[model samples]
Target: MNYENKSFSIKSWAEDDRPREKLLLKGKSALSDAELIAILIGSGSRSESAVDLSKRILNSIDNNINKLGKLSVLDLQKFKGIGEAKAISIITAIELGRRRRLEGALELSKIASSQEVFNIMQPIIGELQHEEFWIIYLNNSNKVLLKEQSSKGGLTGTLVDVRLVFKKAIELFSTGIILCHNHPSGKLQPSNADKLITSKLKSAGDTLDIKVLDHLIITENAYFSFADENLM
Candidate 1:
């Protein structure tokens, strides 16, 4: 029989022929996003199948294979089969379900210990894609007043300026500052450059009469505190 003569109706096909029935008979993990979406879309136009359209969309996203976040309606409106209404439905539906992880830095509790501050900060800045240095400005009572990204780029002993630290501390009226940075490698071990930079900041803080409380090395999973180890 010629392939062109074959029937295309999904109902006329076998139990194994349908994506939905295959998922029900097997399990959900066995189905690709395209297969799953084919079920939601029901059927396709004469020119294209539902599965194909879904494949195009999933592929356009670089096959992320996870829940789509920030896949804007505007981004999807450019796709062939997806109109504004469909794109809006998808984006709004996804956003409604997302309870974004809030690593609360705005809590009223004053950070008493270096370790306590390290724990709170580890979740936010530790897992960043790029190297960024942050300063936590502390009030006279050692409570956090402002958290700001001090610099953005590679961190070396000579690259960081102590003036920037004092400038920010003065602007925030902070009596002390906690310096922190993330290790893209997740090592949590301070380098020779890190030590040199800290020593310079300590001297500057002494001259400026602003306390340099601690320097923290943050990794995605953990943190190393200079004060905790008596390095500060």
Candidate 2:
């Protein structure tokens, strides 16, 4: 028997072992990360099963789903069994999950602390390779009105148009605004430019009676708050 070139199809597995059947019989939560991904890819190459291929892919990223989500289509297609379609399926699923999380975070009607701001903004810009500036517009009672991306830039920094920032704030009748931007470098410390921008926005907000409640420097895992540190 030439086992070297054999293909192990998912159908050969027992009902409980097949990723799709396992999900239908047990539950989605019952499936391992690789099993779920196996469902996405649907099939394997001549040398392995979909589950086996998924495991190998996950292992390449140390089994971190966040890292997996960051993989581009080209990046994923480099794997043995992952072609363009399978790679797209993985990317699309990851993106949908991210949007679901973002929607859940936005359900926070009222902003209470800097942590809440992070929860709302992290999904929008946290994992990016570039920088994005966002403003969280709030009513007098701290209830969120809107979150708008103010600008985008490269890995180093982004330009913020202070006039546009307050223009939307005024239009929304927002009494307060939270400034936020991501540091893709994952450094939580506010840089000199960060401080300067915060100062400029806070000064502008003061004139219009729109409070700059906090300015958050967001990263993938953590955040820094200007107000919390009395920098505001």
Candidate 3:
């Protein structure tokens, strides 16, 4: 075989420079994102090593892993040397990473106060451009049973049903519930609708023997707590 015709492979590279080898020697965290992707791809075209191709692929998406994770198999196959198998490998890895994140969040099952609730939710809903309503169910000890999104709507408003909220709390055997939502406009002040909903949910919770712990209005930079303000 002509030397020029030989495709580049990770095995031919120096041990420390090869993705798999480097991973073994320095540990997985020591590898770059492209190196990790290259290990997944396994091979590359005649002109490029897997690492080079992986770098090119990431660059195409501006190195944004979230955008790359959203790619379909067909979309990935548009790149050279990335066929059906490689595309599947990439997508499967991305999905696993996403699941791990959700699992980590679930592991943080206990919450103590409104500020703790804010810390947990700030990252999830703080950056959204629209309104979202969430209910967190807690046991008697304030251990979080589940966090559920109750409603999502446009920039101006979101509709949340009180019945659905209590139903979920009852199903979870929760003793307390925390209500939360975001104001995309970065206004922390609660609207009249906000006041009315807070009153309605609190009343319903009381009748059902479930305590309404707090209602928080969140924004990108600030938050308002109804309980802290003596409105609850």
- Model 1, stretches more than 4 Å misplaced? 1-103, 154-158
The candidate with the higher TM-score, 1 or 3, is: 3
Candidate 2 vs. true structure, TM-score:
0.94
What candidate 2 gets wrong by more than 4 Å, as runs, is none
User: Tens-digit lDDT track for model 3 on 10-106?
Assistant: 8888899998989899999999999999999999989899999999999999998876876899999999999999999999998887667556656
Candidate 1 colliding pairs: none
Better of 2 and 3 by TM-score: 2
Model 1 CA lDDT for position 210: 86
Q: Name the best candidate (by TM-score).
A: 2
- Candidate 2 lDDT over 1-232, as tens digits, reads 7888767999888887999999999989999999999999999988899999999999999999999999999999999888999999999999999999899998889999999889889999999999999999999999999989999999999999999999999999999999999999999999999999999999999999999999999988899999999999
Alpha-carbon lDDT, every model: 0.72, 0.94, 0.89
Give candidate 2's error at residue 28 in angstroms: 1.3
lDDT, candidate 1, 47-97, per-residue tens: 566677778878877865332444667777677767776667666545443
In terms of lDDT, which candidate is stronger, 1 or 2?
2
Worst 10-residue lDDT window for candidate 1 reads 96-105
Could you list the CA RMSD of all candidates, in the order they appear?
7.7, 1.5, 4.9
Q: For model 2, what is the alpha-carbon lDDT of residue 142? A: 98
Which ranking of candidates, highest TM-score first? 2, 3, 1
